[model samples]
Target chain A: MVTVTLNGLSVDLRDRAVLHGISATLRPGELTGIIGPNGAGKSTLVRALLGLIPATRGAVEIDGHDIARMTPKALARLVSYLPQGQALHWPLSVERLVALGRLPGLGPMSRLGADDLAAVHAAMKRADVLHLAGRTATELSGGERARVMLARALAVGAPGLVADEPLAALDPGHQIDVMELLAAEANSGALVVTVLHDLTMAARYCKRLLLVDRGMLVAQGSPQEVLTSDRLRAVYGVTGRIEFGGGSAMVVPLERV
Target chain B: MPEIPVLRARNRALIPLLLLGIALVAIASLMLGAVPIPTARLLDAALGHGDPVVRAILLELRLPRTLVALMVGGMLGLAGAALQGYLRNPLAEPSVLGASNSAALGAVAAIYFGIGDYSPAVLPVLSILAALASLALLFVLAGRAEGPLALILAGIAVSTLAGAGISLALNLSPNPFAAMEIMAWLLGSIENRAMDHVWIALPCIVGGAALLLWDGRALDALSLGEDGARSLGVDLARTRARLLLGVAIGVGGAVAVSGSVGFVGLIVPHLVRPLTDRSPSAVLLPSFLGGAALLTGADILVRLIPTAGELKLGVVTAFLGVPVFLVHLLKERRLW
Candidate 1:
């Protein structure tokens, strides 16, 4: 299991600060939801965590190793990332697309081995895209594409999985399906983190929530402690109430504040 | 998921077929010319046992020309596949992106200024430098943008600028013969080339093609777009640098010897892509072989055609490439 820690992490893009000095510790074997309003620097934070962008200050550590000093291949072997609104540029087969996730583990001249193929098969099965293995990825529907991308990420077999807005184009049923998959992954002893916009899903599915607004970490706790109506009004500009149903909390927005 | 055995088998068969086509075309290239040799005599000459004249023509003249055509064509095709995969654009190629034209401009400058009289090496070295310059400009203009339109526009700017430079050199010639020489060279031909030209181009072409084919896996990961590929451990800045240097060295070496051959790069990948699994990596090797076959076959046709003067190889490739390119534009209009 891997533990990700952020110590006073700040990010600047194009000479403008997008994320302030924020610190948090995220543990494995739990699904943590990062919730924030639009343009709240959620994407920037995730990118910084993966070392896709340089941090203006401070550092991100995984299992006590600073990611700043880690090679891209080493970092990728530990953490898998799924970005938002990915567009397919080629007509690759689904199986081949998923097999690309094994790139971090592959040598420059090595072909895919039996272990790599097995990982691809398991990822496709888990993401429920096994039937689409032979289909061209570019021709799939948006929902099918989302799940296929999820399979591609899963094929990495990294201990930590970070997905940015995985459910944006998904239908409600597929949203629940994706959340359940992340929850199952966490239960199977992986660290699963998702940047979510849906408060209800975040509350119901995630074990803990990190709430941010305007680049600041406003709150971080369980669904009951972090989803307070007053905090929602102050941060999201929406008046909302947390309702208990079936042993979990769900946030329902009443009106714009 | 179970493997699709039929599809897998078909994909595996394509490489051998392509290699067979290249070999047959190479042999035909050796046999057919202004003076045709019978098959039995050709084989005898190949074994160094035929008439001296036949042996000289086969071993010295035809062999070097055939080798140059194959290497130049293979370089074009491999570079095209690599560029298209890296940029995620179907239309990306060395000529279209101005690397070939810039190299041609450099070669023309060397010839026009009489610097080529000093050494045969001056032409290729200067052409490679110029190709490197144009590729640097290409990345400066189009690298940060996300869409194909930006890259295409940048390519147009570079190509037009290089064309203008070439025209300027042609307009102000020292003599009529110099003007004629520039015009003929610009038409792109592999005729009358010797083994010296082959040796000059071979090292750079082989090295550049190695750099391109080495990035096959990185190209496959780039199908996920830049961010996704980066997250998967592809070093984007490094990949870009390697592609630029590779295309420059390869195209510069080719243009140094063959002049401004256009459209072979653009055409071969499109023809070979459908036969593979359609992944960027799967398209590289077949495209290389297909390119070799296409150019060798085209050279043989130029010899066979009954025109008073031999047709230029560039003209033939343009005729073959434009219609296919237009068809792609009409069919995949939504891609941009």
Candidate 2:
């Protein structure tokens, strides 16, 4: 029911332009993977859209309003985001971490209500972290922590999610589980966008792809339409194969010389 | 009655904190003093009682210092908790940003140049101004950096420079006795302090602590990185500025009157965290009371150990603080 539009967005960090005039649209009910090499301005693009850093030349819009104009709680209720690496401040329980998702819905003077509790319980169930709800987050394995963070994000129940490298530290099992979860979210109507380095997972799960080289959006289409070996080699300096059938597709990238 | 996990956890922490805080305040104000004023005697004197001398000692000498130490301790604790919460670093103290050293230098400047002797108000003013300056400098330096550690490191550097400046002021003094007095004062001893000192810092400490408490939610958002916090609707610039101002002035006022009291901020926050469900807001008032308890106890310890020739409150804190900090380091093995 809603969409995100990035228009001529530019970003600078450490006095250098990291994301340059790159534009993309994220549609509803689809898992759009923003794929690229390391330091390809993928995260920068997300940060720029969230109005974290000042855009040099353009703007990002959610639901047809400029993102910068949206209030923080409003934006959070609409679109949730996760960073590449998030460290914990304390050894909070999984449920406590998930409850922070309801912060946007909470008023300044108001405390959490019954709906908040139900939402937190539902999110924990959805992320499959229900068993770990009472356990300390720090005691969990890396994959478990990732799942809890995902649960926290899903707890927001936003219309759109922009997660940067949510699967980086996950095990192979968790990786697929998280991908399937994202796919399920999209299937259920939320627009889930993720920046993934795993070409295999990206190809298998995402409904659409946006490939970038440096700061430019090099290609955008379905898995069969894009993610070709030639484009992969050009952008990533590597070669890859794409296999499609049985309602699934996979891309395996070969080593570069 | 809310049984949500976060609510339950917070509830578990809050009850003990309330009891312990009240107990600490009671023992601090009533029992731990040089004259050993019993609760009954204190109550009678507080109620305008029978013995004139008991009433006078309780009302005049012990009461002012106790209230000042309590207030100053509370301020440092709150300041420390706020700065630590703001940066999400456990090691941050009120003195981290060179505010204490800057205030000490200001106090030394006032004393050395005879400005403090000129007007009763000149001393705290000089200390506050220099502290605010150091805070501004810290902002300029840290604002240019990416990581929070960089800002803390910058604050350490500023602290060292201000410390050296204070040393230079001592060395340049013409009167050796006065120089030594200023030096000892700068080392932070709360002895022979009068009602005048209390009047000077009480308003500033009270006001600054209120400012720090007002931003509890802002501190919570900052737990999310600037980017994530922004998306959640925190105005980063305004939040950072207000906290910095609060930390700087609160610390400056306390240190100006009490000399350079340290570790109250560090120790209080650490001790209060486990008691506050690790919630920054819950930690705020408890940290303040905890700091007051610790520092006032240290002051009382200083008075009790006459054979040690009246040790400085700072020395007692350092002696206790270093061991506690080391134990924490051994346990956590990581920064907050």
Candidate 3:
């Protein structure tokens, strides 16, 4: 198992700081939810973690190895990322799209071997997109496309998976389906960190939550500790009630108060 | 996934077919020029056993032109596939995006100012420099945007600016004959071109094509967007830089030798896209072969057209390519 640690990470883009002094440790064995309002720098934090952009200060480390120093391929072997909106350049079939995930494992002249193909198959099956493998990713519904892209990320089989708003365009059913998939991945010993907007799903499914607002981490703890009524109102500007049912917490937004 | 096994087998067989087609077209181009050589005599001339006149025509005249056509067309197609894949835009190409025109503008200026009269090398070197400048201009105008519209707009801007530059140079020419000469050069022709032009362009084209082919896997990963691809081990900045340099060298070399041959790159990749897997990386080699076949075929057809002065190769390609391009545009009208 791998552990991702962010120590006082600050990112400045074109004279403007998007994330400021953010610190957190994301560990394996739990699905950690990063929830924030729009423009809370959630995506920026995730990008910094993946080493897509350099941090302005401090560092992100995977098992004490600084991410900034790692090659893109090396980081990819340790962590897989799913961006917010899936961009499909061609009308590639689902299998080929997912097979792209195994790129780090293969060399330039190497063809996909039995093990790589099997990993892809397993990832597709886990994402519940095995039936859609023959379909073109461009032609799929938004929800179905999300799952296919998720499968592509999972096909990497990296120890750490970081996704930005994976459930943004999904229906409630697909949301749960995706949440269960991430949870299963976590249970299977991969660290899964997803940025979620739906607090109810985040509370019910995410074992830990990192709450951010205005470019800073407002709070981070278990669902019961982080999703309190005062925190919701202060951060989201909504008066909400948290309910406990069937051993899960659900947040019901009362009104914009 | 099950269908992929069969498709792979089909594509594996089709690669050789494409190569064979290119070979046939190359041979046909050699055989069907003005004053056609009989097959027996052509083979004799090819192997150094024919009349001196036949040998000169085959070896000195046709051979260089044929080689230039093959390299120029293949380079265009390969560069087109590479650009399209990098920008994630289907419409990206050397000529359409004004890179060729920019190179031509530079070469035309050189000829107008009498630099080309001093040495043949001056023209291509200046043209290559100009092509690189145009790409740099395109990046500056488009900024960090990654969509088709931004790139297309930037390309059009660069193209129009270069066209204006060419026109201004022609208008300011001291002699009227120079104007006509510049005009003919701009029209692009392989006729009367010697081995010198071939030697000038071939090395750069081959190097650029090799560099482009090396990035096939990275291009595939890039379909996942910048962040996703980077997270998948792709070095986005480095890849973009290499693509820019590769296209500059390849397309620059072609334009330096042949002037601005339009639309072969755009048309060939689109035509070949359906036959192969839709991956941009997979289409690079086929596009190269298809481009060679298309240009070689066009070059030969230009010889057979019976025009008073042989039709310019650029004019021929535009005449054949623009309508096909329009049809593609209409088919994808919803995108606009």
| Global lDDT scores for all candidate models | 0.87, 0.79, 0.86
lDDT over C-alpha atoms for residue A172 of model 2: 91
Candidate 3 per-residue lDDT, tens place, B1-336, comes to 433342235378557988898888888887888788888998898888878998898878888889999999999988898878877878778665677888999899898999998888999989988988998998898757654467678888998999999999999999999998899889887887789999999988998888788888888888887777788898766676677678877888999998878889888888777676677788888888888888888899889998887699999998999898788767745433
Deviating ranges (above 4 Å) for candidate 1: B1-10, B118-121, B135-158, B324-336
Per-residue alpha-carbon lDDT of candidate 2 for residues B148-194, written as tens digits (9 for 90 to 100): 68878888988999999988988889899779879787768767667
Model 1 alpha-carbon miss at residue B191, Å: 0.8
What clash pairs does model 2 have?
Answer: A72-B233
Cα error, candidate 1, residue B319 (Å): 1.1
lDDT of 3 at B334: 45
The docking quality of candidate 2, as DockQ, is: 0.44
Clashing pairs in 1: none
The positional error of residue A232 in candidate 3, measured at the CA in angstroms, is 1.1
Question: Which candidate leads in TM-score?
Answer: 1
Candidate 1, residues B104-193: lDDT per residue as tens digits?
999889888989889777877788778888988999998776545676788789889988999999899889888888888898999988
Interface RMSD of each: 2.6, 3.0, 2.8
Clashing pairs in 3: none
Model 1, native contacts kept? 0.65
